[model samples]
Target: MRSVLVLSALILAGFALSFAVSEYTLRLLNMAVIAAVAVIGLNFAFGYAGLISLGHSAFVGLGAYGLAILTTKADWSPWLAAIPAVAGTGLAAAALGYPLLRLKGHYLALATLGLNVSFSIVASNWIELTGGTNGIAQIPGLTLAGYKLDGEQTFLWFGLAVLALLGLAALAIHASRLGRAMMAVRDDETAAAMTGIDVTGVSVTAFVLSAIYAAIAGCLFAAHVHFVSPDDFNYAHSITFLSMLIVGGEGSVAGAIVGAALLTFLPEWLRVLGEGYLAFFGLMMLAILVFLPTGIAGLLRRWRRPALPPQDTAAGLDGAVSR
Candidate 1:
């Protein structure tokens, strides 16, 4: 019952937000939506399955570049290209996860970082096909049937629709047996394996699912921006993606959306802070780390403490600082 209301509220919020925010703001919100999609995908690996994937931007770049190349060079429809591009990214992630997910913590993080670097290198050097440093230009806008979706207002509706569907789909997945397996794997990999959960299969599934979401987000980004370049999908961008997951409260779908929205609009909001705003941003991020260790979602959960009391204390644990 709570889930139904929450979902309904989200659906209503999307439409309500569209009307309330200005076009310029909606454009930024659109970016947040795309990024939220990518981060939500990241949650499956980093948040749910305890995998640290710093190479997510590479998968996102693949989806964007896939559509860009297809629509421009192959003269394919943007919509048509999205299908194979997303599937190919999922397959690539599964293949890559087999070896990478075997590592833990820093090792896994570095490996994924290396993958992201490799992707950017190829994108920059592959001039003939990828336009090299020039990047791909004149990418086609999104269209369905004969109607073109080119304006910010028009795209906002589309963005809202996509977010609503993806949110529901993600929620459904979270309630499934596979979701339970992922939780088990995250909590205790060895125990999950002992309990008949194929650890490797679960890891691969999480990675592939996350990558597919990133791919779709990438497709939408390309169609919206109508341009693609290696610089746009850098390793820094990967870190930002991870940061969004953390700041939004990893493991919480609502946090993903909230974090994306805040981070997306933050820079614009801070434009008044002169050129040193990022320094302030860094300070705030540190403050968040200190106070809201679980991120913004955690902060919100703290606010809702009465309805959903702390799990640890209810289990008869003492409430005290570790140190």
Candidate 2:
């Protein structure tokens, strides 16, 4: 319940702020929300299940391209197209996960990284389907209650609503038995298997769930931008998604949301540095990594928690003696 309220407050705040920002800022904010969805899903894999996936953006691309093809090629409505796009992405993840999850640590990371690279190669070469580097264009926008979500502000309102619902769902998952099982696997796969937990199953489930979220974000991206190129979901974007999770604090839903928004807007805020902004961004990230290994959410938790009272050593000794 507390999690729900906090999520509601954040969504409402973002929705209210949308009306005041410039159109460009609103567009960035909407993108942040979409990224947040992907990052939250990532929490399931890397955060809870100890999976190192560098191919998250491939799933996102699959979703985006799936919807794009369905809407443009098959003449399907955006609403109906998202269904198969998201499901297909999940199925693909599951198929890949069964064989891929066998690898651990950096090996798994490298494999997933290869997966992203492979996706890029296929998306770039398959010009007939993905439009190659040119990407798909003229994709249709969504309609809500008879109104077109073509404008940034309108689209943001819709995006916020989706984020809120998904955030709640993520929080619920975090507190459930499934979530605990995933965490157990993350902490120690051997121990988890000894305790009758299905380690392989949890890992695959986490990967699939993460891919599903990425795909949903991709669908939203397609609907909002009305265009997607291979470049949009390249390996760089997957790194960005992982960075968002790390910066916001992995294993935390709130951290995911905060990280996405902060990183999305950080570039804009540093635009004053001109060409040097990238350097500054790197420095700040380094500082955060060194000082706050747990990320911003962990820092906030520390601040919110009440400090413990000092122990009375002399009184303790006296009490012990009397006892």
Candidate 3:
């Protein structure tokens, strides 16, 4: 099916990029892959369901800390730790969703922002568990059939494989009944309620799904770098994730991935601008926002659309004149 082609194309793209880029760039690409997973999750909450959650990084932190603690303290396998890390984050989201989802608009946004701040504070003070600001280290990396996957190239391969699979899952969700309900609730809550859609339930489901994706990204981060700190998943990171979604085109899955990659490498690309790079970068983003409000994906979509023939246009005008 189309999903298979997408998956294959993504894998092939990663394979091609591996040879075309440097080792350092590969590391950045790996990070982008991890971030793409989280951003795609954000697409569910914000893009599809119109739930503006600003505490997404907190879920990522929970997952990273969860795996770090398990692998370090209990000597559990990274693969085994991921299960609880992801599931626990989802559960936490569900528990928090009902009360939090009650608030609409900026109120909900503030609540989630508060959640991220609170998570950062706890992660910093919880010396025994999260290692305070020092973070957890010496965590083990993944292995496949006795082959170690610790190198940048190897990790990129693994990250790409994970990203492709999750990408497909996100696509599936976008086509499912739940996805439709989420969109309906997003478009108009009152109308959706009138149609018998469980607005609250849909919102909660979207939040939890987003959290699960964040957790998976978190686990990958923990395993990849073998270290994690409160700073790694702070409110700033949540903002960056949101920015990725916006710049990539919020409602589209392809847009999310494209945005994640573009933003991830953009700063590096701008490094040639010297110390003024950030200023220029900000201006560029501003321009993109002003002119292409639909994001890069939207622009690409516009380019891909075929133009009507001149005769067809004239015939359409003639028909309108006759009418």
Best by lDDT: 2
lDDT tens per residue, model 3, 170-268: 888888999899999999999999999999999999999999999999999999999999999999899889889889988778888888988898888
| lDDT of model 2, residue 280 | 88
Model 1 misplacement above 4 A:
1-4, 307-323
* Candidates in descending TM-score order: 2, 1, 3
Query: Which candidate would rank higher by TM-score, 1 or 2?
Result: 2
Candidate 2 lDDT over residue span 198-242, tens digit each: 999999999999999999999999999999999999998998898
Query: What is candidate 2's TM-score against the reference?
Result: 0.93
lDDT of 1 by residue, 111-147 (tens): 9999999999999999999999799999999886788
- Give me candidate 3's TM-score against the actual structure: 0.91
**Best model number under TM-score:** 2
Candidate 2 least-lDDT 10 residues: 314-323
Q: Can you give the TM-score per candidate against the true fold?
A: 0.92, 0.93, 0.91
Comparing candidate 2 with candidate 3, which one achieves the higher TM-score?
Answer: 2
Lowest lDDT 10-mer window, candidate 1? 314-323
